[model samples]
Target: MTWKTKVNSALEGITGYTIVRPRPQAPPPKDTPRPPADPKIDRLLRAPVFVLSPVRSGSTLLRVMLNSHSRIHAPHELHIRRIAVSLTTEPVRQAMDALGHSPSDIEHVLWDRMLHRELVASGKDIIVDKTPSNVFAHRRISTCWPDARFIFLMRHPASIAGSWHEADPQERPMEEAVRHTLQYMRYLQEARRRYDGLDLRYEALVDDPEGEMRRVCTYLGIGYEPGMIEYGRHDHGEFVKGIGDWRDKIRSGRVQRGRPLPAPEDVPEDLREVATAWGYLQES
Candidate 1:
């Protein structure tokens, strides 16, 4: 071999050794797209009423009462916020890719299984999805299913903040909690302002559940049932207390949940005004 040929071979050998082939370039993965989002899911199974509220706003009690009517199915928090709009257009393949699984894999089947379970549990034509956080996605839902009726639950601002603090002591940060509470309140108000003929209802359901539930059923154009009054008496598993942790929190006098909660009279003047507007008063 020529001297130059040997040098070139040596250089090539070094290059090949150093630049390890990127393990047989896998065929450029075809653009695996997600399957179309099911339209049925978007319309909430064609349910007439869709409840939207902030957390701990007596929605659970509302849900139970709604379910008491044979024609109504009030499922626990459906968490439709992620699925209703955000993931609706995602292709099945893309969804699986996002979930790190094959689109048709049986192992990752739990996603649909659980989601469908909740969907199926909402037994009536009027399925009530009692997710409080869904307030954030109201506009998105409007875009996705404009015909769906939205029933918004509004609580007294002070009690709402107090309920948050009571449920999770860590939920309080003074400024942050206050800001979030105000933001949520504003969001609900904006929904009411923007949507014409919106089925928004305001009530402290916990205070007079029987009366409130009857009104709710009446608004939704559904029959009322007395069974709703005793939802807590049933074996609801994890949802037993529903959002009643606040009762203890309020009784304990922790500002938030575990912290020191202010009395209705003791609430800051500004917050107190907000609470009063919503019909909440201190227990005299």
Candidate 2:
């Protein structure tokens, strides 16, 4: 079986959320009353959010949960930061019709425009993007929006690696796991060093979504809403069908708390600092 199958099978065994693709649906009702907004929260809502993580680490699931909130527009991967990284001076200048803008400003324009459109269409003010590749663009995103929030979502190394191999079983499983896990850890470490945001573990989320999401709402300066846990059942947007089967369960429109599967060997000694920092290890 594909490594993806292993991950899907294990997750499916515990709770049964099946894959439901995003189809055309009526508008999501906006009847949730808004509480008084803090000026601090007002500022935060104006800034974009980059939900960073490696692929198949449950970022999509997190996005839907956050989107269940009254104001937050947590959408599927848009990879805005990736666009920032790919920009060149000349193209940016040309796009601006000779208007003066720093490279950072140009990238910000790109991010802002896309987010503005999405938020407008959704009738929500805040935009949360769950692009695992956004870690690549974190620096530029921060440069553009100094107050931007970075949420690092983490799953166990074993599950992440197993899922990776299942997506494409031809690759060397150990190398893929070690390389991607360490890379994600590096970004998480740097983000902790540089930014003020939350570091949430996937395990914690599945274990106690209410408590974990409450903590997240606190971090984001928003009140906790019980709707966040029932995100899977609501129609936030068209469901995203991604590579492999890891995301199918969340598409079932309800969060299913999965039973713990066997964990891979602890992270290697050299990388244990970050692994431990992210709550993935106790010791080297």
Candidate 3:
């Protein structure tokens, strides 16, 4: 017998137990075709709002303003997409299949129930989820909540890169910031092209908070409230790191103007196309 085998046998005899290695598990399938939502079995929340934007685009600011309204509850980044359901046993899988529920369908139900619970707890008529990464899963979100509404938030691409780097200079260098932030920009642009939603710019938001907020209220089919412009007066949960912007600027209570846009010539070549498409740059 092999030396390793003899050693293992000896250890088993001395210890009175054999080593048990876990079986390898296959990775779950991705992009499983989700059946269309059926009102009879689908969403618990009606017409939920999703704000799609790149990181450092002032979504936290918008969320706070929306939260200030009496009838609206704009919670911090609830990355519900990351919350997954696993079928741990054959019987569990068989039971779900018997109910005509695909793996994705079960996940959809879980996502909806969680959001609806949050909404009910807050006692708000509308719930807005402003997770920036939601742009990457925009199609899946649409499929999950067929009656969902979208709000596309835009910013100058160079400014977004600069802000992302500034948020943590040591952890997020300029080169990496540009590359990482660009991914979100591309996905957000794709969603904007495909979905019909209200578009708001960060620059415009800070420049005229009242006007922009009024427009948002109108779109959501609610009357504009003065409290929305004074977002600092209300409690908008915590400004924690992972959940949303945790910077002092967000904690300041009132709307502050955004940084000046980078010069057209200073815009990076990589971001020029998206900038031009977003109206921050003119095509040469």
Candidate 4:
């Protein structure tokens, strides 16, 4: 007999069962349409804002600036999309179904409640979550809060990759940085294409903080406050790693000028398309 046959026969004789490996579970379906918000099921938190951006795109700076506003509370990156629920038992699943709740619906309720709690605790009229990874779940976010607003934060693709590599050069080499950060750029671009939102660039924001803040305030239907430009005076929580930008530049507590954009010729071939699309490079 072959080695496999012998091993299986021996295992069956010893344990009364043959070796069986479990099959890999498939990923959940994508873009499943969530029902529009129902008054009875969803409440609390109105016209919440989301800053969709890639990693190392200066979202933290924007967050703190907006947070300094009297009426806006831009909190640290709250990765609510990563939070999930599981129907562990049949009874629990049945109960949810009886209540006309799908798994997604329950999770949406939890996400809403969490943000509402934050907004209430801060005593602010508006809440903004600037989690970069949220670009992947733009659809779900739009569905969860029909009145949600978005700010599409754009940075030069070459700058994003260079900064990402510098953030952890040993772990993120230049080559890998382009590949990894490009995913966010693509998703951010797709969200921009599919959604209606204000587009702001990292370069312009730093060069003209007051001008951009005024524009943003206008979009949100609020008067621009001068304090937003002086965000260094506010206590915007701990500038720790992971949740958001935790580098010295962010810790500087000022709107520092962004790095000069790479020349068109210096832009990496891999990033050329996106850089041009984002208006960082002129189309030939």
Q: What TM-score fits each model?
A: 0.60, 0.72, 0.90, 0.88
Better by lDDT, candidate 4 or 1: 4
Give the alpha carbon lDDT tens digit for every residue of 1-98 in model 4.
89988888788787557678668756444335485548454757788999999998989999999999999999999999998888766688779879
The residue-by-residue lDDT of candidate 3 on 233-280, one tens digit each, is: 999878999999999999999999988889999998899999999999
Off by over 4 Å in 2: 1-45, 84-99, 241-246, 259-273
Local error of candidate 1 at residue 176 (angstroms): 3.4
Candidate 3, residue 123: lDDT: 96
Question: Ranking under TM-score, best-scoring first?
Answer: 3, 4, 2, 1
- Prediction RMSDs, each to the true structure: 9.5, 19.5, 4.3, 5.2
| Per-model CA lDDT versus the true structure | 0.55, 0.69, 0.91, 0.91
lDDT by residue for model 2 (48-142), tens: 77777777678878888999998899776775655642333446546654654445445556666777788888887778888776676677667
- How many clashes does each candidate structure show, in the order listed? 14, 6, 0, 0
RMSD of 1: 9.5
Worst ten in a row by lDDT for model 1 = 250-259
lDDT score, candidate 1: 0.55
Q: Give me the runs in candidate 3 sitting further than 4 Å from their true place.
A: 1-31, 35-37
Error (Å) of candidate 1 at residue 187 is 1.3
Candidate ranking under lDDT, highest first, comes to: 3, 4, 2, 1
Which scores greater on TM-score, model 3 or model 4?
A: 3
